[model samples]
Target: MFKGKFRIVAVICFVLFGVMAYLSSQMSFGPRDKILPGIYVLNVKLSRMDRDQAIQAMKKMEASFKQARTIQYRELSWSLPMDQVGLRLNYEEEVERAMSFGRTGSLWQQFLERREAHRSVHLKPEIHLDANLLEKTVTAAAETIILPPRDAGLIINDNDTVEISPGREGRLVDINHLQQELIKSLLTDSRSPIPLKLVVAPPVRSTEEVSAMGINRLLAMYSTQFDPNKVNRAYNVSVAAAALDGLTVAPREVMSFNEVVGPRSTEAGYKTAPIIVNNELVDGLGGGVCQVSTTLYNAVLLANLEVVERTNHSMPITYVPIGRDATVVFDAIDFKFRNNTDYWLYIQSHVKGGTLVIKIFGNEQFKKDVVIRSWIEETYNPDTLVENDYSIRMGDRLIKQKGAQGYRVSAERVVMEKGQVVKVEKLPTSVYKARNQIISQGMAPPGDILSNPELPADDSPVNGEMEEAEER
Candidate 1:
């Protein structure tokens, strides 16, 4: 009888424990759309909330974190929005994560999760930060705060005096450290304003360090003029010229136009302008850049440097004299010259008013007077071609198309020392193809000749300029 009584009490205890376990899981399984009770992320309670409600709850925390988040350096401060630096919390993932707690696992594990939820489960949201975006933001801020160092320069006085300009030190931000600090400030609830870690950046070299590394005197200078009214083309010309400023080449080194200027696209800050293609000028990117190269080529020739490679346009360009202009295309065609002298060759270029000028400098010992001479070796006028038109009279003519004159031009570099031509080097011969003039003759009568040999060949009039020329 005592044994029977013990068995009954054991059965009652088992039923009580089963009821308690079910009660725990029942708390977790209260509603399909709701999160279990007692869940929080960063002190923001998320219990009994749906996915949307939980996301809305997390945004409150985001707003508090983003309030007045500023990074200050000196007198400048950048108010960083979450999107600027690509710092954001994946609210959808966080809500899903919060909802997954008691709803996951088997019944036993669910009960355990529910029990743990009563004790309060706290978590941090998944942070998404793009390193590149962060760096760009910091760099933009640094650009505003930092003062760039100036390098020493030279000025040629009117009385033939060489003046050396002074150089100055600059201050720059500690980028890596600043990035770390930014990340730390973002991850924690630090209310202090972010401070920049700036470093003193000295000049690349002292002005007095080496005044003459074979660059004591100006070797040659060439200038080309452009119409400032052509806004896009002028901008491209200026950009290309600026790229060549302060360019230095050691002895035996070669300078390439395409390499220095790089790719000319909208991304590289070039606008569409007139470009020559198949001897016809059309709207294209980096149109006026060739003018920069042409000017540089003339300067290089006047400097008596060795020309490694150069190519002239299919047709004669109006900016430079025939056989003097150099045409360059990225990757496919390039303008290159070698620094044949023992001293360093330095190139300086700038655009002023409406002119682009390029100057070459090197040792005074290598300086020689160079005069460029060019002439037309052969001229080929466009031949007139007539097409009989039955709709018009025999002697009457209608101009269908205009034509261009072709030429074979030659250029020579006359190097002079002490007023005597020491060397005369001929440049590559340039040839332009003649475009045939088309004319329509009236052949209204059956009596009109099928092939008019005695066709009158006088042009009507030279009216407006070609549309292509105006673009240039």
Candidate 2:
């Protein structure tokens, strides 16, 4: 009985020691005897661990604690915020590395709290100058500057009355400079509005006004005395006057005589008659009008104007010489001349001394001695008389016989220059009719002692001797 009890006690003790060893392994802490005194508590908790799973539970808790302790808190700057973007990746990597080491639970919690606090920190931005604003200021400073506008006008002096001149006080503006200033101002960003400048320039004058002065001087030098009231009866001065209204002769320009005078006719209030072709009397328009054109032609030549076109009359005109006369027929006939001088010309026409005269006023060079002359080339006979023959008796006897005839004619002209022969021109040709010639005779009685008183005395010679011979 003593041996049995001793063996039983040994077996019970063995069982109890095994159970205690297993329980110690399952717990979060190692054995009390093996652990150091005042050791830091990890505070790891495992709610669903089996009693036999204490060793495996302790190993898992140790891994988690180490991973948490390895995690670090990071602070970032707003200017260089790249850390924020990389923060999550860095945190995950640190956790994985720490987990490789052994630290558990409460340590992991403390590391997470530090990381959150760092993330919550706000970063401030640094102060710096704006490059765009600086560049704009630099450009504005380099722009061109301009002056303001001012008023100005012309001034005259009593001593300079004879010579009209421009005043020094007149405001003058440089157009090119003004344009540049305008462009610069428009491009500039100014706080105040800049008003446009007003520029004053010298008074503008036309070319015509200058030319008028020259024309006036020329007219004063060459103007001649002429009587408008003495104009010839043949020309209708009133019509010519009307056509000349508002007519101006430019320098070195030609004027057409026919074109200006137009057609002369009763409709135009012309009462004068003109000789026409065939010597036959005919009432027509512009009959005596050639006198006007002829007069103007002479005046133009005297003025030394260049003749562009000139046509002679088909027949002689009593009013003017052959070559000197100009005939116009509406759109068909025309006489034109050019002003050959540098000055302008003024034309004036009037009737004087039973003649129509045209005067041209210009420079003195044209007013020199000038003359025209003309004459007839041939004379034509007038119409001849016709005689008629008729028979009649004192008492039924033939008495006498009669007969008749007719004739016609023309003339030409010779133009002279300075008493020298210049040209021989034929004027309008004239045609005349022939006159009739007539004769009459009577019969004599048979010879029977009949004495014919109509016989000449020469035929009655020695009548006494012939009578004596016949008696024998």
Model 1: pairs clashing at backbone N, Cα or C within 3 Å: none
By TM-score, who's the top model here?
1
Q: Can you write out model 1's per-residue Cα lDDT over 295-387, one digit (the tens) per residue? A: 999999999999999888776767778889888889888999999998887788989888898888888999999999999999999899988
- Give the TM-scores of the predictions, in the order they appear: 0.64, 0.34
Give the local distance difference test score of model 2: 0.39
Please give, for residues 88-169, the per-residue lDDT of candidate 2 as tens digits. Answer: 1222232232222212345444334323322331111111223344223322322222223222221222331111222322
Candidate 1: misplaced stretches above 4 Å? Answer: 1-24, 28-33, 69-87, 102-116, 126-216, 224-292, 313-321, 327-334, 338-356, 362-366, 375-384, 389-392, 397-407, 414-424, 434-440, 445-472
Model 2: residue 232 alpha-carbon error in angstroms: 13
The stretch of ten residues in a row with the least summed lDDT in candidate 2 is: 463-472
